[model samples]
Target: RAFSLNYWAINLGFAISSAGAGFIAEYSYLAGFLGEALMTLVCAVLVFLKVPESRPEQAAVKTVGGKRPKDEVRLTTVLRDGRFMGVVGLSFLVSLIFQQGYVGLPVAMGADGLSSSDFGTAIAVNGVLIVVLQIPVTRFIQDRDPRRLLIISSLLAGYGFGLTAFAGSVAAYALTVCVWTLAEIVNAPTQTGIVVQLSPA
Candidate 1:
């Protein structure tokens, strides 16, 4: 529930700041960035003040089937595991593609002469679609095997990037963003779940 709380807090804080900015600033972009920075600072302060460490002391020493290993599971062991390393590598590549598309999109749309409203509309569409589709799509795929889901999600992510290569308008860009956003929703939760499952018993 922390994730949901944090998400709502950030969104509400930014919305309020943006509304205030609309009254005080001539340009929306600068106002938005200022709002973001201020909100980030506030979040940092709250985290520093209120958040407690959640790590469990026995996490590394879990005994499986009555056998206690000589050594505790360490960060280095987790990082060195081949499967875990593969997940980290895949996650890095996914993040690169996601960030590049997210950042490059505005430049691409602007180069095509799209206005601020058009870009904002594209983002709105992305947000709306993600909200409406995420749960239903996830529920439909919930019963599928995790490995297959991972593979399919990866392919969908690649397809999203491939679509971006050909996007010439705001609508096309929005479509690509939706595809990638869904891929992210599918991939992220499953990966995290698997990581938790794979932790030493």
Candidate 2:
């Protein structure tokens, strides 16, 4: 539920910004860039005002019980954790497909004779879908097996993102984005939960 709400809010912001960006860019890229900068500043201000500091209230100390407790979990310890390493490796693979959403998708669409506006609208579908489906989907999958969720997410992400190669029109590309966005919603929280479990407490 934590992860679901986090991403739900993020995608809501993305959906609004992405669609608005298209119209803004159509007039002036300068204006688009300025708008992005302004939004960033607004976010910073909001965080400063609303978010409490996470730092512990205790006074700073060089050691706990005369020992470096933080350093107890060493890099070597994490590297030697095979299960954690394996999951991280798999996450890297999934990220490769996701990276294409912002990187290769636009380039490929452009090569197929689509305009910048078309790409914007198509990619916006990704954010919109996440906003709509994340909570409901997370509710359904929250207690299910992580292994099964991961497997299904990987397949859905692979198939949906891979289908973009065959997408010729904006609608077709948007459809492909929807497929992968569902995968994204599933994979994100599931993968994050797995990593948290594997992490050294």
In model 1, where is the ten-residue run with the lowest total lDDT? 1-10
Candidate 1 ranges with C-alpha deviation above 4 Å? 1-28, 47-53, 57-69
* Number of the top TM-score candidate: 2
lDDT per residue as tens, model 2, 1-201: 897899899999998778777667778999999878998999999999999999769655578788876656788889988999999999999999888899999899989998778888998998999999999999999999999999999999989988998999999999999999989999999999999999976
**Model 2 misses residue 23 by how many Å?**
2.5
User: Between which residue pairs do clashes occur in model 1?
Assistant: none
Q: Give TM-scores for every candidate, taking all chains together and pairing residue i with residue i.
A: 0.72, 0.89
Give every collision pair in model 2. none
Question: Candidate 1, after superposition: displacement of residue 126 in Å?
Answer: 2.8
Off by over 4 Å in 2: 57-71
